[model samples]
Target: MDEDNIQDDIRIYTERRWLRFSSGSYFPVYVLLAASYLLILIYFTIGLFKVFPCGPDTRQWEYFYGKCYYFSLETASWMQAKARCEEKLSQLVVINNTAEQNFIQTRTRNDRYWMGLTDRDREGTWRWVDGSDYNTGFMHWKPGEPNNDGHGEDCAHVWGNGEWNDVYCTYFCYYICEKPLPIRIKGHHNRALSVP
Candidate 1:
């Protein structure tokens, strides 16, 4: 019957489409979706494995550019300030670019603060406490500054306007500390953090 022929044609068309999709177009689409999902999951998982999660001890610290910073409340000698930061599992702040310098200037606007630069090891050869090269890093020294005045100025401090000047390391001054972000290990714990 013509009706039966038409029915058979419809069934054949459906079968052709289903077979094409299942064996051809649909398989590539499924593989592409799975690959995309795997890449996305890996990207996020790498972040977790690389950075330590922020915690209580740094509850009062400022966050910038994926790092935590602590601006000291009291003044201390450069060495003392360095030791204090070490106690907190951090190092004295190292400004690496204009953006970082500007960020700290927002806090240093009206007060002098100790940074991590010192030329004590070799005069006129500035170095960051973290061992980063100063010659290749950012510098915002005040005009005619870092003169190593009185032949004993080996430490660097930021002025209210954010320019740097060489000073005696023994001078007590406000300081900044930069907390290092390391991968979190199982069973690792910092001091009890108090949230406000």
Candidate 2:
């Protein structure tokens, strides 16, 4: 071939090669990178679940809705019950919904049980021990109840009929403990990240 023709062909080839690089020819590379990251995310998510459990491993505790519950037949005053739950690395049950309330009520229908609810911080303004608001979600207080009757009732409890009432903090009663889980696996910056 002539020198000029050869030179023109080379320039055209180089331009086409540059266009290929800057155009959709690299779509596979982009797709591949995205797939790799997505796979990584999936792996870590599944690994987190497999590496840790939703609740403590024991027969006494029942797992429900990412929480663990323990019912105590032994009775104690409201304050003592609260402390007891904390001692076991849990807190008094906070019924967040009708389903959860039903669950605890079914278990404690035979006797009164202290719950993690009280207006002790401010009278007439109840709140759960775990910082959950009292008035935000499901609450099963009896009609005309929490009048702070008598000397004043600052604690909450479930009755035999599954209704709720406020009684004196010193009142002794059975108690239920609750612990929400996917517990921290330790060694991370306080974030619930799974490492495997």
Candidate 3:
């Protein structure tokens, strides 16, 4: 009888040991899975900024010659358009290279538009309306350009093929504007993006 009782006690103890061991082992696996889920959630939330996917206000801007551009302003005269852009703390669009000129031509709907390049200061010596000196060799002139026709034609206009032609300063036309992008805000975090 003594030996029988001892054997029964041994069996009970072994069964209890297995039950306790399995419970402890499975607990950690559950914990690991939960931790993995939490990590995935955190990574996804931080990776993508919360800006709207696409719209007029959330639109991305293009850059040219290290300058940022906006849609062409359709309202106002060439002079008034230039003044309006300046009032917005920007300047009339000053295209730098062939690629930029091509881009504006693509973006604009009107065939004729005003740009920063003008001959207003010296009548025949074309200069950027913003007073930036011309360094590149990307001149798109209509045939017989810079004729200084009628003596006071100091403004510049883009023709259908993206060519520049001298015109009177008072003539009105659509214009482009440029300004620095505002800082992006994402759920209390300030995000910076490289301009494309």
* Most TM-score-accurate candidate: 1
| TM-score versus the correct structure, for each prediction | 0.66, 0.64, 0.60
Return the lDDT, model 3, position 79. Answer: 82
The lDDT values for all models are 0.83, 0.81, 0.68
Among the numbered candidates, top lDDT falls to 1
Which residue runs of candidate 1 sit more than 4 Å off their true CA positions? Answer: 1-53, 182-196
Candidates sorted by lDDT, best first: 1, 2, 3
- What residue pairs are clashing in model 1? none
As a TM-score, model 1 comes out at 0.66
Which of the predicted structures, 1 or 2, would earn the higher lDDT when compared with the native? 1
lDDT of 2 by residue, 73-176 (tens): 79999999999998877889988888888888788866999999999988989988888766777878789887898767999999967888999999888999
Q: List the residue pairs that clash in candidate 3.
A: 116-129
At residue 71, candidate 1 shows an lDDT of: 93
Off by over 4 Å in 2: 1-57, 182-196
